[model samples]
Target: MLEEAEFDRDDAAPIDMLESYFAAHGWSHERDDDEIVAKVKGSWAEYELRAIWREDDNVLQFLAFPDVRVADERRATIYETMGLVNEQLWIGHFELWSTSGILLYRHAAMIDGEGGGTLTLDQAEMLIESAIDECERFYPVFQFVLWGGKTPKEAIAASLIETQGEA
Candidate 1:
């Protein structure tokens, strides 16, 4: 829940900043963050999934997932899967900004907002991998939307960009 940021004009690209920051904290992206952000913004292909994790005061603890796609029945399927009808959970996208792991986006949702929960490394990895696997399972529908026919790994990298404006 980070408020307005007073960003420095000389701030490095988010990916670089995040990597250095995470490395300092003993964390690292599975792949390069710069390339991922570029691909997502450029939209070379449809990223199939996206996710983010935040801690107290809106600082992001973790962020990952495949990019999003907007094709055919797949779009509907994704929304349906994520709807969580009776559950209170919602999907959130995180944009990188600081070396301290703070998020820049404001529109992030609270999945199961009524009952907040903790996220562990295992949970984060599971959620991200599951989303990628689900998208792969529904390849026919997802392929036509955003992935631009690239492999799942590429899509995952693209997802790291963390678009703030797009829903």
Candidate 2:
């Protein structure tokens, strides 16, 4: 459950901390009044990280995604892949934004107050790392579907084959 009382932007927005976090990581980012967008490079892909402060809802919404574009023709298969991928262990989930044709990982944390928990710098890092890690782990499945023309089932099956020791 979450409280619905409106909060002042200054009091509720954690944009400053978020900015500081991005700076500490040395990632290029831009911040507006209530949102920060950062560019992150991971092992498997480059990602766009977006965090929005919702004062009224006391929620911090975070989204991170690789630069893959989902075409309209493949949207249904991608959605099916999203469902299969989401069924595995998860903190956040993948979504393909229909209008934008972008696939992203999204998670939200309740920031301080009644019914809202706290968000420390460490927790924020964990939250972000979780998203990126999931993206890295599953990037191949998405690719298999979009580029390799594999069905949702086949894509996930191919990704799950744990290879032997590295070459």
Candidate 3:
């Protein structure tokens, strides 16, 4: 499990460690108070992912909002598809903001107490990489459903179908 790893906090905020990790990878990010926001470019879209450190709650919240907006007419279908997608996801889950009709992926990593748990660089990288990869892989499926008028099952099936060059 992603959250099962023991991180050595060393009495520092997890958010600070996250900032350093991003810097080490040459990814430019902005830190605002307790939150860090970074823009990531993917194959299909540019994503803005935010990591917020909730010190009092001992949790690090990560959120990614794709550039696509769920059309009002397609909201129902998208919601249904998201439910199915969430079931297959191991770490984070996709959710729709009802008011804005925006789809977002969210995952929270628990930091045990003030000095019990630590967020290692590897674990942090895993969390970010998994989220970005999943979004990149499924983004096309979302477009198929919203614009191509395909059913949820059909969309998923089409997305999972991989093509290979002649070998």
Q: Say which candidate scores most in lDDT.
A: 2
Candidates in order have lDDT scores of 0.33, 0.81, 0.80
Ranking by lDDT: 2, 3, 1
Report the Cα RMSD per candidate.
15.4, 6.8, 4.3
Candidate 1 stretches with Cα past 4 Å from truth are 1-50, 56-118, 143-167
Give per-residue lDDT, candidate 2, residue 128: 76
> What's the TM-score of each model vs. the native?
0.27, 0.84, 0.86
Candidate 3, residue 31: Cα displacement in angstroms equals: 0.5
Q: In terms of TM-score, how similar is model 2 to the real structure?
A: 0.84
Local accuracy of candidate 2 as per-residue lDDT tens digits, 45-148: 88998999898888889998788899898899999999999999558899988789999999988787663434565556677778888888899999999999
lDDT of 1 at 47: 36
lDDT of 1 by residue, 1-167 (tens): 11113222223333333333333334333434222221121123333232333423333333333344334434443343333211222343323333332212223323232334333333333444433344333333334323355344453444434467856
Instruction: Rate residue 49 of model 3 by lDDT.
Output: 82
Cα shift from native, residue 151, model 3 (Å)? 0.8
What's the number of clashes in each of the models? Answer: 13, 0, 2
